[model samples]
Target: MTADPLRIGILNLMHDKVDTQLRFTKVLSEGPYNVDVQYFYPQTHYTSRPVPDLVQKISQPLDLKQVATMDAFIITGAPIEQLTFEEITYLDEIHQLIDVLVANNIPQLYVCWGAMAAANYLYDIPKFQLPEKIFGVFHNYLRAQDPLLKGLPDGFLAPHARYAELDIDKIMEDSRLVINAVTKNNFLFSFRAREKNQYFLFSHLEYGKDALLKEYLRERNANPGVEYIKPQNYFRDPLHMKDPEFSWETTQRVFFDNWLHSVADHIATQQFVKE
Candidate 1:
């Protein structure tokens, strides 16, 4: 008999909301299993900024009642990495949502700032500001054989664009968290809390080929006077922005496919136990 479609929810907090949804949806749809995706945003945020018409058509304000029904959830990264946790206007609402997810034992995948935020809120792993943004496609070496990274090779390339780093020492000291992957510089790539059914990815595996390029251009235009750093090791010709390689395409497909498989296994196991 065929299994039910995986009910996955995404709490998208990125500025380019539509692109974020599309990229993640593409990766999530790569596997064999059917996936039902629910997109959400912080209602408190919309109260201040005008909700984009496209966002309104595609997503809803975060609903605690509905969040519990998801088999798995993804929280996307925001551009607001410079701000303190308390400085975030909608943090309390997000905390409440996370608490509900925790209470329901929902599997979570926190990407970039979302990962940092969740790490701070749940495990007290504080985020420290970096002198400059780590903007590039870096090689990430696998450190553990976690189910989430089942078929991936020893190393893979992933995009990074952040101004903060999670306290590595604190995470290493925390017995509950398992460090899965890290860069040669020892910057974290991915980690998981087995007890909480949570995964944290500092790198952007779901980024499209032009994602970083668009970000660079957008930032450049937004602040014409300010000198912006081009995404390193990304453009074939840094001057002209020539044919960029989609190096992480296969890696993302495999990673997200493994994640879905892992989630499916967890669901099956839970069902078996309940039976």
Candidate 2:
């Protein structure tokens, strides 16, 4: 008999719910575990607005009372990088969710802005704002060995589009957090807290090939005066903006697959101990 599908809770802070859902499904599909996703949104930020039909299925209010118990969890990036963690619309609610994840020892993947928030709220790690957005597919090197990045090449490209930096020194010194990957510029690429069963990625590995281009165009159109450099090592031609390499697709798939497998192993181990 087939094993029951893993229930994955996604604390989706992104505004574009449909696009985010698509990227998540595309990546999770690569792993062997079948997933039942229940979307959670902060009520203050999203309110009672009706979600599209596609989102309606998986979406639910981020109610602390419901307290979703999941096999794994994923927190999507938000555009609230400029604001302080406490300044976010639903302050206590988000923290409550994070607290639950920690208290329950749930395995979690925090991406981009979500990673920054996790670092801040969990460990009191501060973020530094960059002069300009670090928008591109950057070359990242392996900092240490970990299951999530095991099969990846020595160095590979990961997409980033953020305007702030996490305190690298603090994370490095923390005995609990393992720095698995870092960029040449000292940007924290990925880190996992084994004891807490949490993973953090500052880059958006689930981004589609055209995702960066769309971001560039949106920024340029919105603020004509603002200088928006095209994402580095991304476009086929800077002028034409054709042909993205999609170099990170496989890495993205395998990363999530590793997490799923790890969660499965942890559950099995617990079951064995009980039996």
Candidate 3:
């Protein structure tokens, strides 16, 4: 008999193009599991308001039933005020999703803003505000060995875009989760759900090179006079932005490949069983 395809539900919290979901699907599908993606937009006031074209294009309500049918679910980040979960218009919907996922013991992966959402929902911790926006490729160091980081180098670079940080102390306070990695800025890089099959990443492991430039341009346009006008000095000169080699597409692929491999065992166990 042929093996069943792994049904993967992608909860895209952002109001950007579906490209983020597509990139994630591309990487996860490369492994032993067959992947399927479904997007969910939280029905909240903030999302409903008029916003950028990118946000409008990707906004839609995601059915919860999709969560029940998947072997794994990946939740993308969103742009919102992170001071408190209440401030996020989709706060209730996110909480509802978390409750359902936890009840079903479903495996999940949260990236960037998704990570903050997971952290807030899981720990009741408030998100920290940044003095400035965090953009470009940032380096992360594995604090300990974990399945997600297996076969990967000690340090890896991934794209990031946010102005809020999570409280590591509060995250560590929860005995159910494990901190897998940390950045130099003392931010959580990666974390795992304690009892349930869930993993969260605060970095954009699925972003390609072009995506980074696109995001940079978007931010540059959105906030022209922000204090941090210049890109991070660690990356190559932005003057060579046209070059494809400087893109982080390869890094994104590697990160996704490792994540897929890490979840292979779980995928096998949850493979579709015909009635």
Candidate No. with top TM-score: 1
For residues 212-260, could you state the per-residue lDDT of candidate 3 as single tens digits? 6666667678888764443453345556655433444556666666665
The candidates, ranked best first by lDDT, are 1, 2, 3
Summarize candidate 1's per-residue lDDT along 1-275 as a digit string, tens digits: 12789999999999888899998888888776899899998988867679878888889989999999999999999999999998898898888988988999888999999999998999999999998888888888888878867767777788888889999889989999989999888889999996778999998888989999888888898899999888988888877877777888877888888888878987988899999
lDDT of each candidate versus the true structure? 0.88, 0.80, 0.68
* Residue range 1-275, candidate 2, lDDT tens digits: 11877778888887567788888887786577887777787766646565556555657777654554677788999877877776776767777888887777678789999999888888778888888788888888998998988788877778998888889889888888889998888887899885778899888888888888877887788899988777888877767878877878877877888888888887777678889
Error of 3 at 45 (Å): 5.1
In terms of lDDT, model 1 sits at 0.88
Instruction: Tell me the number of clashing residue pairs for each predicted model.
Output: 0, 0, 1
Give model 1's clash tally. Answer: 0
RMSD of each: 1.4, 2.2, 3.5
Q: Higher TM-score: candidate 1 or 2?
A: 1
Better structure of 2 and 3 per TM-score: 2
